[model samples]
Target: MSGSDSDRESAKNEAIRIIATDTASVLKFYGALEPSPGEEPLPPAEIVTPEWALFRWVQVQLLMSLDVFFRYRGRVPEASALTHCWYEKIEHDFLDAEYLVLGVLEGAFATFERKLQAYWQMLRPDGVLMS
Candidate 1:
């Protein structure tokens, strides 16, 4: 491959890495909010909210698309499209419920919530236009 093609491939791989890592971190943080079956018990009130559940569900979808993207690289247009769509959903949900979600999380999981927020901000398009 030419230098330009190699650079493009590298950027694609970097994007995949960032998405996969951030998704995993968010998933782990969400998992931490839940109580294990037996050893660790949590109060009913501390359980994940419906919004969190929805967020997690969408994150899982994004992860699945990321997996397909990794397997096929840029060859599978559908996988890339799905990944972008799912990511947009996540961003929209985060922006819309930022306060509600963070308020609940800040009480007990402040550090994790902050980290998740940072990740969310990092994913934003900012000045760049996304295709």
Candidate 2:
């Protein structure tokens, strides 16, 4: 293959690797919450640590961002426009979901609600997903 073709192939492989890595990270974050067979069931409040909450928040945000990007893929007017739109939607959805989850968990664990909200915001910085 020509040099340009070879370069394109390498870039494609790199992009695939990155996507696979992000997907694995998302799955791992969610998987940690599941109890293994014969494992004792911890209460929801006890299960979510601050660190885990932060990681979960990031993974959820990443997943939402990926969804938005994929939805707009091949149709966005410009790369920046795609990113701008994704961020707008993801940020709104993240806050909405966080509060919704907090509301559901509040009756049983009020403290968890505060911790989750804090951790979610603490980890809420700009993120980019591979196109």
The local distance difference test score of each candidate is: 0.46, 0.46
lDDT comparing candidate 2 with the true structure? 0.46
Give per-residue CA lDDT, model 2, range 33-85, as digits (tens).
65679997644543444335444454445434554444454254566565765
The CA lDDT at 54 in model 2 is 43
Model 2 sits at a Cα RMSD from the real structure of: 15.5
Q: What is the lDDT of residue 19 in candidate 1?
A: 48
The numbered model that scores best in TM-score is 2
Model 2: runs farther than 4 Å from truth?
1-24, 27-51, 74-76, 79-91, 100-131
Could you estimate the TM-score for every candidate?
0.25, 0.30
lDDT of 1 at 101: 41
